[model samples]
Target: MQERPPFKTLFAVPLHCEGCISSVTNALSQVEGILSVECHLEHQLVEVEGTAAPSKISKSLQDIGKDCILRGSGNANSAAVCILETHAPNVENPVRGLARLVQAGPEFTIFDISLKGLQPGIYQASIRQNGDISNGAASTGGVWEEDTRGTEARGRLGQIEVDSEGSGGIILDISVAIWELIGRSMVLSPGTELFRQDDEATLVGVIARSAGIWENDKVVCSCSGKTVWEERVEQTGKGML
Candidate 1:
């Protein structure tokens, strides 16, 4: 397997003093696949460059009692995100998973995905041809085709095995471009089959552009009048892991 190149990910952390910086750096340094760690006490930001999943980094910080939020990732115009949701009427909270895609190089992209509130079983993920989720994954069309050669579906992102607690995640290096996936839809369907349609347990979300490093600096949301941490609480309350 080809080694994945390192990419930068910035996070807004609560840094009060130099000790905080040292602690954050130490925690991240211990994480596997992390190449470098830089903490800015003045800006209260932590910048990590490596092949580590952002979620893993965040969890490490959280384990040390530090609250951190991902501010940006990748390079300009090279990052995207998706919120995988189930549109089944019987399901109260539709959200079931999340996906983050960042272009690590000219020939490949890094895909970090997480799932929660799902049954303990195997599931498959894929990028569909359309962005529509009107009928959940059923409306998203087929898996994205790389070309007309009828070759393998480059958008098939592979399997995720949920634990008994209904959570699972993975970081993958795939041969696809961030630009090619914009405006598409990502589906997480229960089973090992790659082309299964939407079911009650299926989760779907649209691919949307996400901020790159230093691109988003707002600490407060303009529409909600809530700080970033406050927004995080709200999202957490909504079952976003």
Candidate 2:
């Protein structure tokens, strides 16, 4: 397997003094894929550089009694995101998963995907040619074609097994560019086959550009007048991972 290159990710952490910085640094050092950790006490921010999944980094901080919100990741114009949702009839909450994509190197992009409220089975993830989700996954076109690597189907992102709790995730690098994925769509389907039109279990979402490292620094939402942590609490209550 090719080693994944390290990428930078910024987090909004609550830091007050040198002790807080030490605690945060020490906690991150224990996480297996982290290459380095930098804390900015004045901004209450932590910059992590490595192959560690953002979710794992956040969990590590949570374990140390410090909550963190990912502010940005990767380099400028090298990050994107997608929120997978189900459009099945009568579904109260459509959101079922999230995908974070970052260009870690010139040859590939890293994908950190998580799914919840799904059946216990294997799910196939793929990038589609179209971003349409009006009729759910059915509306999204076929797998994106990689002209440079003809017949290779670079869009196929392999599979993730959902556990009994309907949760599954995978973190790995794919041979695709972040710019190429923006405005496209990602679909998660049950089983080894690509998504079928009738499969209600299918989750689909459009990929959108996300902030790169240091691109976003606001600690509060101007529209909601809520701090990052406050917004995080609300989002957590809504089943955001």
Candidate 3:
């Protein structure tokens, strides 16, 4: 059988100058499965073409002190993206990821989740509301719903199976409005096995909900009244679009 072509992904990172671009391009080119790396400094974007796992690419850039947010696979319309992070203090192996929501129809959305640094196995993922965990609280229990008390599964996102390299991706069909999902979070937890055990450690970290959906041609920044793309375009110009 013939090998498949490498996939491409865009990352919104901190790229300020030619030096930064060269550094990121060189660093990504060294990754084993990466086929090409293009840095758009004006837009602070790094476009990577590769068969390597998405998480691996994100981690490599992060390891070199370049924080990045996955911006989807070259498509920049009507999408919301989040950077998933670990909140556990004592855990050694940390989980990191990117969750993207794309409008599929009137009332349905597709969730594209890519994660790294997880144990190789099956895991359950769900969308959770921001509960009573006050903002000033020391720890919000990492936002994983503890029991069935007030937590009801809104949409069955999908199952993610991490490979031996601790990287995985899954597409979830969500039956909800994009507007309804803005401030809520996504959580990855152990499968039903954890339900039987009284262990709090079964909880995984909360996904850092970042951008909201773009309605029509407008950028949906509830606070600033400007969309993220609009701000990027204003600073970087139409070339980014």
| Best candidate according to TM-score | 1
**Model 2 per-residue lDDT tens digits across residues 1-241:** 6688889999999999999999999999999989999999888899999999898998899999998888999999999999998778877777889999989988689899988999999998989888988888888888888445454788888899999999999987888789999999999999888865745589899999999999997877999999888888888777677
Candidate 2: clashing pairs of residues: none
TM per candidate? 0.95, 0.93, 0.47
Residue pairs in candidate 1 whose N, alpha carbon or C atoms collide under 3 angstroms: none
lDDT tens digits, residues 186-210, model 3? 5566564222121222333333333
The reply for model 2, stretches above 4 Å from the true place, is 146-151, 198-200
Tens digits of lDDT, candidate 1, 79-105: 999998888787777788889888988
Residue 241, candidate 2: C-alpha displacement in angstroms: 1.6
**What are the lDDT scores of the predictions, listed in order?**
0.88, 0.88, 0.57
Return the TM-score for candidate 2, rounded to 2 decimals: 0.93
Which is better, 1 or 2, measured by TM-score? 1
lDDT score for candidate 1 against the true structure: 0.88
Report clashes for each candidate as comma-separated counts.
0, 0, 1
Root-mean-square deviation (CA) per prediction: 1.5, 1.9, 10.3
In Å, residue 163's CA in model 2 sits off its true spot by 0.6
Between candidates 1 and 3, the one scoring higher on TM-score is 1
Predict model 2's lDDT versus the native. 0.88
Ranking by lDDT: 2, 1, 3
